[model samples]
Target chain A: MEAIYIILAGSLVAVSCGLVGSYLILRKMAMVADAISHAVLPGIVIAFFISGSRDSLPMLLGAGALGIITTFLIEFFHKKGNLQTDASIGVTFTWLFALGVILISTFAGKVDLDQDCVLYGEIAYVPIDLWITDTGTIMGPRVLYISGSVLLVVIAFIFIGYKELFLTTFDPSYAAIIGINTTLWHYLLMGAVSLTTVASFESVGAILVVALLIAPPATAYLLTEDFKKMLIFTCIIGIIVSVLGYYLASYIDGSIAGAMSTVAGLIFLVVFLFSPTQGVVFRNRRSKLSMTLNEEPI
Target chain B: MEDFLYFFSFQDPNIRYVVVGSVLLAISAAIVGCFTFLKKRALIGDAVAHSVLPGVCLAFVVSGTKNPIYLIIGAFITGWLSLRFIDMIVRYSKLKEDTAIGLTLSVFFGLGILILTAIQHSGNANQSGLDQFLFGKAASLVGQDLIVFGSVSIILLLVVGLLFKELTLLAFDEQFGKAIGMPVKGLELVLTTLTVLAVVTGIQAVGVVLMAAMLITPAAAARFWTDKLTTMVFLAALFGAISGVSGAYISFVAPAMPTGPWIVLVISFIAMSSFFIAPRKGILYKQFQQRKYQKQILEENILKAFFHLGEADEQYYGHRKISDLISQRRFVMGRLKGGLQKLVRSGFLKQDREGWVLTEEGKNKGQRIVKLHRLWELYLTEYLRIAPDHVHDEAETIEHIITPEIEARLEKKLNYPSVDPHNETIPYR
Candidate 1:
């Protein structure tokens, strides 16, 4: 009975992560998200230190705020500084993350936080303290409610901005020329991603959270370029993997998040290699030169 | 300080274990990283570092404890799997290689996190210490660890040494290597395995977050100092070993210092040095050489100009009244004065009681500069697709820097035309 609830919670987290992850993957922000995840550690630590508690409100707010800050800083450095985008992303987040680790080591030792806690969290055990109480009937873990609410917010965020988001992501210049606020859309996209990542951190932890945010949507993208189809495919893949990953974790005493991601990674591999529509051969050929040419223009 | 240095020698059994272990692994990883850095997959090492976590976790689970052998096996398995998955995503999906790397990296790292949290909850002290694998605990390394690492290091080195020729060719020009019937895929796999092994070896000393540096920065730093692959490999090994031992020594001597960040700090220092300070290609050196060349060209041009004025008038055209001519000659006056005085002593110029004069030799030299400058301007306007008025600035620089080889190539490619685009006469050498 409890296992069913764990599956629901896990699936909810997976779908939420995957949906927003599509945007991140499309924008090549997966690594940026990875960096943001680490950078938020210090924020969460500071919040916990202030509140002297591990509950949702302060930690969630703390992490979310820092996540947004990390997003802005990464974008800021890439735009303003001389470093290339990837290098900027790497430097900002790693430095911030290292600072977070050092802080945890120095000050948060009294707290239950460590780099391990930052890396891993057990969703099945989340039910130990968080049980749903409805009409005096004990029900799902409370994480489902929190993650589900955040997921709904994310879904609404995506729903409202779908066309605008697509336009900005696909062709920012065209969107700008057509009078769409591409800059606003970019921030909105980043804000949504950061919030979802922070909300899911305790349920899945920071390190593996990137896999959820990236792999599924990428897998779906390989399956099709149609945004609507891609979203649907990604959500479905997330749910399926959530259930399978949970079972594998339970049966083998392995990690649910790890299993799902590895499975997702495997699915991504198959699609990557075998996708008839968008395979390596096409990409390789295209890069070699323009079409209908006997040889490249040396 | 003297006592510290004396004790720091690997001759002591305690110091021996740490130094030898670090040095051997450093040598192995540095050599592998050299190839990856050249391939421009430097950040893939970063991705692979984060991607091996879940495997390490699973290894613990499979062994029902934090067994080193099982953990290494688990880490290796997942490392290979992660690399394969990343490759597939990049190959098969619409995602860029960066995206795939980012995705796989996060997912694997997150999974590792999940398992570790579960282990912590299970009340395993052994599991708790496994967290150090993420950042490293170099101080705990002992003789047993050294033996294990030393054996693996030797094996890895031998394999790489035997396969160096193929690896170099594969790195330098993949198509050429494949054309020569080299097993590209097989060699690539071997390279990947070596890279993963390097990352794994580093996790013990530098930790996961900083492992990429141990793999990439040494090689990057080494490249600045050498062009030979052999020298680069040797230098990278030296840098890597130095960083590893420095971090280890710091941790050993100072009880609370973590090894990973220190190692990273050292490697970053090396990278910074390579970027600005390596000889020949160093920014300061190049700028210095360029300045020197410009000065030489200016002096030569000035000498030629004075001679032209002299020849055109058959007098020391040193009309002290023409300030523009004097200013134009200002740049080269110092060097040209020496040549001028000799010309006067040998009676090539007469003191006109004005300013200065040039002999016939100076006249001819000045004529060549004027001729070369006009010819280049004409060439730019003609075959090289420059606008008529756009010829001056480029000619100014090219007149200073154009090499003999390029001059020959320009002459031939332009079809040896007698007149330039601007209708200037061609001066054939």
Candidate 2:
């Protein structure tokens, strides 16, 4: 029952993150998500230092701010300074992250700052802390509720700003001139991303955060072109993997986050090989089959 | 800084092994890196670097001792598998290049981590330095490492020397090489082998992950200094040598500091300097050219005013009110005092309380700028088919910078047309 709650919350978080992640994928800012996920460390560290505790809302905001700054620096270098986008990102996030590591070591000491914790979260245990409510009635794990709220917010924002987001993703220059505040929207969208990752980090961990953000949405993308359908399929895939992943991880006695990520990875692989629209194997076979049929004596 | 390389000599047989080992490793890896950078395949260095981690761990698990042969073989196998996997994912899926890179990078590395933790939890003391491959573990290069590094280096260099011409052709243009019936796939395989070898060699010395920099930044920096392929290869080799030697010396001296990050620091410094200071394509040179052109534009405006002064009234001869002559440019009056003073010393113009005017030499100089400007306008409007409204400003910039060869080419291309798009007569020299 408890594991079921963790799996549900985890999948909702994946769905929420993936909904925003599709546009991010097409915009070629996948690494930007990677950067934010890493840069959020300092924010997490600083927040704990200020409130003298971890897991606070303000810290999430602070991390969100830093993530946006990372985005800005990436933009500044790639656009204004004309640095190659990938290299600029590589330098920025790593430097900031190196600094964060140094800070945690220097100030926080090695107590809670293990590298494993940074890479993989203890998702199997989320149900233990988050499920029991004040009423003593099982509210299920509350992260599922929080993730549900975030999903609604992201889905609403994506809905309201669909045309503008679509235009910016396709032709930024055209979008810029058509009176859209591309810069403002870019940062705001990045903030939503930051919050999504930081909020889910406790449940999913930092490294696998990108898996949830990228994999399910990318799988949906392979199956469909319509944005709404992509979002729907993205959520369905997210849920299926979240549920199946919990059972699989328990079966292997592995870390839940690892199992979930591997599950998402496997689903992506299946879709890439078997999806009728864009599957590599399917496409190649279809073409070969068609060619053979054409050569037949009819 | 120069003294640091001295601590790193292979002279004392005690250190001789390390020196002989480090130099060969650096040189060969760098030579291979030059091609990787040229192919714009630097990030593949990063991918291969991380991908080899599982190999290193697997080697430790299989061999039961830190034998160089087992580790190298293990690292190479996984490293090779990663390259193949990266190819498969990109060829088969919608994963973008970086996405594929980051995905493969983290998953392999994470899996490596999980395996390593399992090893550590099992209480194996020998597995201690294995994670150093993440960044690097330079201080651990003992006598055994030197032999491993030396043999690999010798083999790498032999491969590079044997296949240099083919590799160069492959990097420069793959399609042309293919169309010419060259061995594109074999050449690509050779290049990948070299890259993997360079990456694998650095695991014990520079470590694995940061070894990518030893591959990437040196070649990237070397690119800015020269256009010739041979010179680029030499420069990249030089930069890589500096990183290898300096990083080793620092690790030796500091004892606690890792060699990998230090090597990256050195490579980054060298790369940044090249980006800003290289002669041909450096940012500073580009800025200098732009500034010089701006100064020349101002001088031309003065010259144009003096040319107009040639046909003005006698009363205005000595007292040409600079105000009447000031046009859309409008800054001529403000800065022309010092410029006109130089012109006067050059015996090209005269200036006094009656205002300013032109001498014979000054009038001739002004006529030349006007001639270039109008000629450029005609070239644009007649030959290049620019709109008439756009001709003037386009010519304004072009007249100042176009080389004599360029002017000649434009002139011949336009067939020496006497009149411009604005119907102004072009002055002939």
lDDT of each: 0.73, 0.73
Task: Give the clash count for each candidate.
Answer: 8, 3
Question: Per-residue alpha-carbon lDDT of model 2 for B15-105, expressed as tens digits?
Answer: 5555556557777777998887767666677678767877887788888877888988998998888788778878887767766665666
In the order shown, the candidates' DockQ scores are 0.23, 0.23
RMSD of 1: 9.0
Q: Can you write out model 1's per-residue Cα lDDT over A1-298, one digit (the tens) per residue?
A: 7788778878888899889988877776677777776678778888877887777789878887888888776676445332345544554565456556666766645776765456555676766756645667776577888789989998998899888888888888999999999879877777777677777777677777777888788889888868899999999999987888788777656667766776776677666656767767666676566654756465
Model 2 chain A: lowest-lDDT 10 consecutive positions: A108-117
CAPRI class of candidate 1: acceptable
Model 2 per-residue lDDT tens digits across residues A176-267: 99899998888778878887887777777776777777778778888998877987998898888789778866664556676676678778
State the fraction of real interface contacts model 2 keeps: 0.09
* Positional deviation of residue B24's Cα in model 2 after best superposition, in angstroms: 4.9
Q: Which residue ranges in model 1 land beyond 4 Å of their true spot?
A: A1-20, A28-100, A108-113, A121-168, A171-204, A232-298, B1-12, B64-67, B91-96, B123-128, B254-258, B280-373, B381-397, B403-429
